[model samples]
Target: MQPPAQVPPVPPPEEEPQELARFREEWKAELQRRRAATAATQASSSPPQPASSSESTLPASPPAKVFVPVSVSQPRAGPSKNVLPETHPALNGTERPTYVSPGLGNALSIYRQAVYAEQRSDLDEALLLYRQAFRLDPHVDRAYHREEMLASILQGQTAAVKKLTVSAATDEEVEQLASNLQNTLALSKPVSTGKAVVTGTLASLISGFPQELAFEPENELESVPIKMLPDELLVLVLKKLDPTSIERFARVNKKLRVLSLDSTIWRNLVSKTYRPPQIPDIEYMIPVIEKHLSDFRRVYIEQPRVRFDGVYIAICHYVRPGLSENSWVNISHLITYHRYLRFLPNGQVLSLLANEEHSPQQVIPLLKPSLRMKGFFLGNWHLEGTTLHLTNLIDASGRFVLQGLEPPSSAPIHSHLHHSSNTTSEDRARYVFVMSLNLRSRPLGRWNRLDMETYESISLETGDATPVALKHDRPFWFSKVRSYGLQV
Candidate 1:
């Protein structure tokens, strides 16, 4: 069979109304009339010729009229004749044309175009526009952000907009308003007023949730079980949990956060951690809590307390001259050592200094006082503000000796050398060491750093106190020890 021939489609039966055709003709004639009138006005505005005998004899000629063609198919809202169209150079005479919107001559507008293009997934166009924007103004991003923020603020404040009427503001005026608003906001920061402010992504997300514990039923007909628990009972249950556990529980929901931030829990933990039987009252010892907005959570975070569930370690290094087989070049060795400090809740602290031969993993587990390791020292710590005072420091290893010191004599002439004639070797060896350290939170919330400020050794036999130098000491960083368990 032969292939079927193609059929021509019929056009619509609708015809142009006579009135519409007449309107179109009138519009065309009006455009022509306006164009002719414009040309006549230009001719009249031309400069007159100079009057001369030879020039006056010749008749004056009319000025030539220029009529530029206007495309009827183009949109009427396009750029005016005086505005130049934006164009980009072609690559290999094969690249497609990219049309940019008109009136985007400045950096801010170009940056906005770039952002719009990026949102539409036009990566190539966005990159090109971004380069153009930065080339024109380096701070276009900041200007754009400022304008956007001001626009949002104005849009939100209907009453203020009506009162101040900034709709007619120029670009410079808008910028000035934004700057003034920023300064005013900075100056009007909220005072503490004893109110605790919860900040962070999680806090903001849960802000609108109910403060009371909320439980959803598994079925529409079933009742929730946790909704019956009273706040007092819940608080008591939270009290039994450790600080870390309570924090983890609080992260479950907003209700738990409010319960975790209860003044009783944090206040009790703070008192138990800081106040001992020896120091019945710690008001003078710790910083004033009111300054921290009287918030127990803030006080717990900002207060400097020696942690017992971890070891504070300081690693030190120094260059030492090494013995060389050859007599030509002197060799220097870098010596490494670590100092460990473990504090107890009863005000006792264990300190030990070990060489690099014994790594932290090998030495930290053997840091107990019962082991009596070499260089192990037992001391008592007292806290006053950020400063920590360690006194009555004595050798626990029982191997330390004070060299180059003369023994006690029965004669009264050399009594200054020793406290008494009956001073034993053990008494002479038991030199009382005193160390002062400044405590600081490295990242401003965790109390995990200690800096050595002063060290002194007091002779029990001679009653002479000598200052010990800390030339090679480093700041101690806290490392949690699982064996020590939770502090509270």
Candidate 2:
């Protein structure tokens, strides 16, 4: 019976071989899938490698293990499973990696370039690039980047940090950047050379409180009221000022305006500054003075004619044609003569004349003798309206001769002398001048002095003899002199 049972030996179970074949096919399929996946990943992630000369002939080595996270129930040598949830959570079926669009990646690249340009101080290019990046990706991060740029500008940092990254930037990071920028700006500001000093008094004054007042009993000091000051006091203060200052004060208020415009103030000013030569009847000149009050201020204060003292010296130039250079044709030979006149307050006058050959010093000696004869002229002057009148002209030549001075020689003395005779009454009459006061009341104006011979001849021809109505010559301008003997 045993020999008959052993005859049918057990062939290996057919089911086991079938199961092994199925497992081998599944394993091969998994290996092929992994290889295809690895090749696709390499193609997408890496650039193509250049072929070497011996690469095609060389034998390939076994591929190194790439420790990628994967789940497998196969037995291994290690005790623990190779799980990498943090690195590749998708493999563990925990979490999938987030996908970023290509457009967003491009925008990020542009943002990085913009940051680099800004760091390089290329603001225009950086701004343009930033705008393009924002247009591509309108996200909160882009908005924050824009805000960061604005904060940089506000902090006075046109150049951004070189290593700044948009992905890592946060509100806290931006705030820190701004703080650092502010600190840098503060350091860059111009520092004062003066040392800083803090006093308790100054601190209290700035805070509007006394240092000890807080702890002391309440006792406030009374404040003085400036507006409550009397009008009389104000007027007194204004009266002490000059006309210009008074005018400025009048602009302060209506009350001061009325006070400054008071006629008495201007009248006082006129009397003090312009002592209009002691006239007999001052009442007659009052109306004239009142009418030209503004003119008086301009002539005296604004444009003062006289010096601090009361004297005026006039230098006159008489230009006329001389003997013709060419006898055949009439040609102008221009000649100029200078005449000096010194005026005093008591109606005294001194006269001198100069030529091209001599200065005033050289001419003074040649005319010294004449200085005794016609050296000085005496007259009484008065202002009628705005016209100056010189009357009672007396020849002091003979009177000085009686004082034991020899008579002047009749020979030509000065180069500009028109006569060779002793100083005559006709010559003396030329020193008397009747001047009209200009609106400026300056010493510059038209004047008519008697040319006795011409006046007599014209009177003899016209048969009028009405003091020979004299016409004023050219304008005679005079400068104010501090003293009578002063030379200009």
Candidate 3:
């Protein structure tokens, strides 16, 4: 039986190559299943690491490319996540990698809001939004912001431009913005070449609401053109503007500079806004008034100043003869003091002592000599043609003392004496000042004394007395001490 089974046992398992091949295939399938499970777990648990430079060449499909226009009018929902490392040759050799991230998307949204606000002339809100966008993502394109800034400047949003310039992170950025502005100005053309008639009532002439001359860019891709408004329109606009605004506009261009010098504009402005003190024969002084019209307007509306607002000095000589022989002698003395006279529009005046020395002292030695004490004089004044009439002089010298000096202990002697004296009301002293307009000299002009007065004096030699009047006409030279307002 063994011999008979030997034939079948001999082949017993002549190991089949097919069986070995099957086992190998089964092992490979199990290994692949384990690897796929591990890979799925890793992909769900963590984000994929960025490929190193060595792995850049690995066979992997690239992400879809996204092109964001430099100037986007509307906001996008979100940015992409797949960012490819690539250099943009067009963006000034910058690495304009796909900036698709949550932070960057929020930044773009904020930036879009800022652009809309700026377009509507809501500069404050626009600036705030722009700052917020940058804070969220500094990697946003600067050119977009630059374009918005240039647009604002072209629209004459000066306050906004100034604020943006101040907010710049570096001087280089400011310089770049300034350069862009200069380029825009260089390309600017006149707003309207046609001339329009300025016909209307004087009151209605400046009543038109200010029309904003904003620059309308042809498209989102083009630079905004600078606006050059017509001279007639400019004049009308300037008439409605305050002096400060007009002055600021004058610095924009040469055309504005010439337009700002229109005499009629200033004259009309002064006549409409200011009421000069009642002047007699004002028609005769038209030439003089026109010559100084600008200055007068500034003085009336901007700042009112008077001639008696500075220091003055005068020397006087007096002679007295004594009862004895060879007793006649002349005494000379110097008078120095500062007078601050502020003339208000309500016909009232404020006078103050601006000098360092309060007490008056004679420069020349004398005995029993009368001294004119220092005091402040107040009253009302009026303008008669080019002359100033100062009258109703009730001395209100009790206000202030000289700088660095204490106030007086008791009321001045003149206050009581003038009140008690039996002098007629007509005998009260009044001052008449005639102004000389010297256009070439500073301080505008000089105030000359048109009236003279006499004072009682006694000689120290023999106690003899006589009346001495100011002989030399000492016109008090003056300058503007400070500006005056209607209220003060």
Candidate 4:
């Protein structure tokens, strides 16, 4: 059958993001309409307006509907006692806060209820009520306060944690206000990214129906869609997403799960997320990617007949030149191994590889608030060669930190130039040069003068340096393969 006609890609308003954007707008308009109706009724009940008839529209904007946090426990009711005041301090205290009433009153009422729920610790009830308010009308706000509250709590908890251990900044109060900041920035981001949205009835998750198309900068779960993304931005988002979320998303929908299986996503994840100088074939890399992805559907890890890692790497070597079994494949790249493989959770298998670089190198390409990052590795390349990578190496908490060149180093170069020199001009120049070699910090980590097997600039600091790093990822495959081992 002929393929679908190619549509001339105009300036898409974020192709996949329309659903989310529409979803938010729909909510905002509804909130406004409800609030206006309530105000009209209130005016009718009061004395006639002055000749000018000014009190036209409420100054407040419509609020976004709150998302209910997903959890294992059933939702419960809020405390019966009222926690928040009926009105803000500036407003008339006697006026009963509009409770999603006929006009602007209803929009304000929902907002009041959301805040009140949090203060009373009626979290579940508040979330439920918040959603109810949003379902009735989603204007007045850009984000659903309850849902934002939930996501914020989780994010703050994770962000404030060090190695999963609680940090000093973590506190009960701080946790409560989680996801709140999303509201402040909602206006800045559109609702959709390639037609994904959170619209539909409350049972959308279970029903699996397509939600409305809208942009949601604060919707969490990678609100930015992959619409017309360049390789650079694509690599960055893939690198930072929480592994679990990507895995879960794959299981949620067939269309979305395939995104997690993108070849580039895995290639970068293994090369940068793990260590460098290790290049496994698409076939050999699939298992690890599938293992980590855990989506209901999985791609194969290797050719139908070749199951061994050695063969897989060897195959990739043929596909791209010198890849080997010892090459590292980050957990995400497992899909490269096969074209069709269904990977599910609870299945277990871990295949280990080797690196011999004793003189550890550090490569960090990106390190900033934004998702973009980069890094490099000069540890070991092809294991068959007589290289120093076979000698200097150590396993620090699963990450292969470079310990420096091995004694029987592969490179035949003398160690004379390797060590730091005296403060003389030549010596000082040498020190500065080596210090500057590091892709990360000049004083801390340094890069090797020679290119690694991939011919990408690999690093080898003076002494053993941890090789794990982050930097702006670039295409490092066009050049000839350089020997990564020391030539002393």
**Which candidate should be chosen as best, given TM-score against the real structure?**
1
**Model 4 superposed RMSD (Cα):** 31.0
Compose the digit string of candidate 4's lDDT tens values, residues 142-207.
323323332333332233223122212223322221112122212322222231212223123424
Model 3 lDDT tens row, 111-226: 87776666556667878988999998775544343333323222221222232333332334323322332222221122221221121132143234244324455577887444
User: Tens-digit lDDT track for model 2 on 242-346?
Assistant: 654787886654445444544334434444433333233322333343233322232234322222222232333333444666788764433443344443333
List the candidates ranked by TM-score, beginning with the highest: 1, 2, 3, 4
Supply the global lDDT for candidate 3. Answer: 0.36
Q: Once superposed on the true structure, which residue ranges of model 1 sit more than 4 Å away at CA?
A: 1-234, 277-294, 326-330, 400-430
- lDDT of model 3 at position 307: 32
Q: Estimate TM-scores for all models.
A: 0.48, 0.29, 0.28, 0.17
Q: Taking the tens digit of each residue's C-alpha lDDT, what string does model 1 give over 199-247?
A: 3343455466654446556588999676799777888998787776888
Model 2 clashing residue pairs (backbone): none
TM-score: model 4 vs. ground truth: 0.17
* Residue pairs of candidate 1 with colliding backbone atoms: 419-461
Error of 4 at 353 (Å): 17
- Model 2 bad stretches (over 4 Å): 1-269, 272-280, 285-332, 339-341, 347-376, 396-472, 483-488
Candidate 1: residue 399 lDDT (0-100): 37
- Clashing pairs in model 3, backbone N/Cα/C closer than 3 A: 191-228
- Stretch of 10 with least lDDT, candidate 3: 66-75
